[model samples]
Target: MKTTGTVPRLTARGVATRARIVEAAADLVFERGVAETGLDAVLAASGTSKSQLYHYFADKDDLVLAVIERQTERVLAEQEPQLHELDSIAGLHRWRDALVGLQRHGGCVGGCPIGSLVAELAGSDRPRELLRAGFARWESFLVAGLTTMRDRDELRPDADPRDLATAVMTALQGGLLLTATTRSTRPLELGLDMAIAHVEAHRLSRSVQPRGRREGPVDAGPARPAGTSTASRSG
Candidate 1:
């Protein structure tokens, strides 16, 4: 969030006020949207005037960047200890359940805060790098965990951590996108299920003294296979 430029150092009160504006703006944008939510709305919500809003953010784009950072933190925070220990299958399942619970709790309102913004502002160059960085950070965490799994012989020696990690994200984002489109968590559940299955499939056999599903994260029943579900349409 720190920009490279000459700027006035804000007093402690000023810092709090600026955070207040950003928090209010974040809430507004998440509920309404970046295009629809205006600076005046942020001003009203934050209980600050135009000058105060501008004092913190150079413009709406600056505010958007801050919101992006806020959302990145929020999303990563939701993953909890599982995110930190994604090297194991149990951690992956925990992460998946956490996401499912999150979608169910929020009623699957916004797909992803940062993701929604990118869909709206993808054409803009200013925030693209920041957005890229945000996604990359999340991916990096997965990559690190998967790498550990590979190194510890939990994953097959031939497995590629980078590709597998990215694929998991692909499934996750696809689910999120579908969730946003249909207003249901089914897609999210299916996507993560497949992604976790794919990851678990690479486990090294115990013949090699490797950690298997029994020693790590284990899900009940065989994976529900992508696209296989019990729900049906009634005529």
Candidate 2:
């Protein structure tokens, strides 16, 4: 809940107004995208005037940043606990299924907000920096989970927790992007399957066991074979 830099203080009405604007903006961006959605559209959607919009954000860039922050907070809030619960392969499968279900049910309409922003601001330093910071926070959360798995002996001691965490995130983002472009959930589903398989294969085991088909069961017996130990670089 804590953020760096100077925090803005506002009256109750002002807070409500800002919240409404942000909510509207998030929805609009998801539905139409950042490039297609404009300030007037956001104002109209939020039922606010130009002056009111300006009161909250200095400009479109400022509003975009606020929306990005809101999205980052939402994603972390939803996934943090789930990521922390991945002390076993079963928990990891459940998380993967839940993620896939989200995309499937939504028809892969909108890609990841952070990923979308990264693509949108590919050439701009400021937005790219913000996007990187957001991704870093998410990756850090995943790394914490991976570290716990290592401590629990669920993962191999030789596994680079940070690198694997980044790989998982990168794969998820790539899958989401592919799904969005193709308007099909197959890519996302397959990508998650591969990611989970990669993790399961590399786990500290002795025999090569195939990944499980069920969504919420840890089938990695004691004799499972360990996969390769190389760390995958992030994109």
- The per-model lDDT (C-alpha) reads 0.78, 0.72
**In candidate 2, what are the lDDT values of residues 1-235, reduced to their tens digit?**
4322344777899889988998899889877888899889998999999998888777888788788888887777766557676655666666776666666667677878778777677678766777788899988866776787777676788888888877888788998898788877666666766666667765766422244323322343423221122121222
Per-residue C-alpha lDDT of model 1 across residues 1-235, encoded as one tens digit per residue = 4742344998999989988988898899888889999898889998999998877777778888888888788778877567898877777777787787777678778887777777787788877777778788888888998898888877888989989988988888888878877888888888888888888778875525444445434333344543332231111
Best of the candidates, TM-score: 1
lDDT score at residue 191, model 2, on the 0-100 scale: 70
Q: Which ranges in model 2 have alpha carbons more than 4 Å from their true place?
A: 1-8, 206-235
lDDT of 2: 0.72
TM-score between candidate 1 and the true structure: 0.87
Alpha carbon lDDT at 5, candidate 1: 38
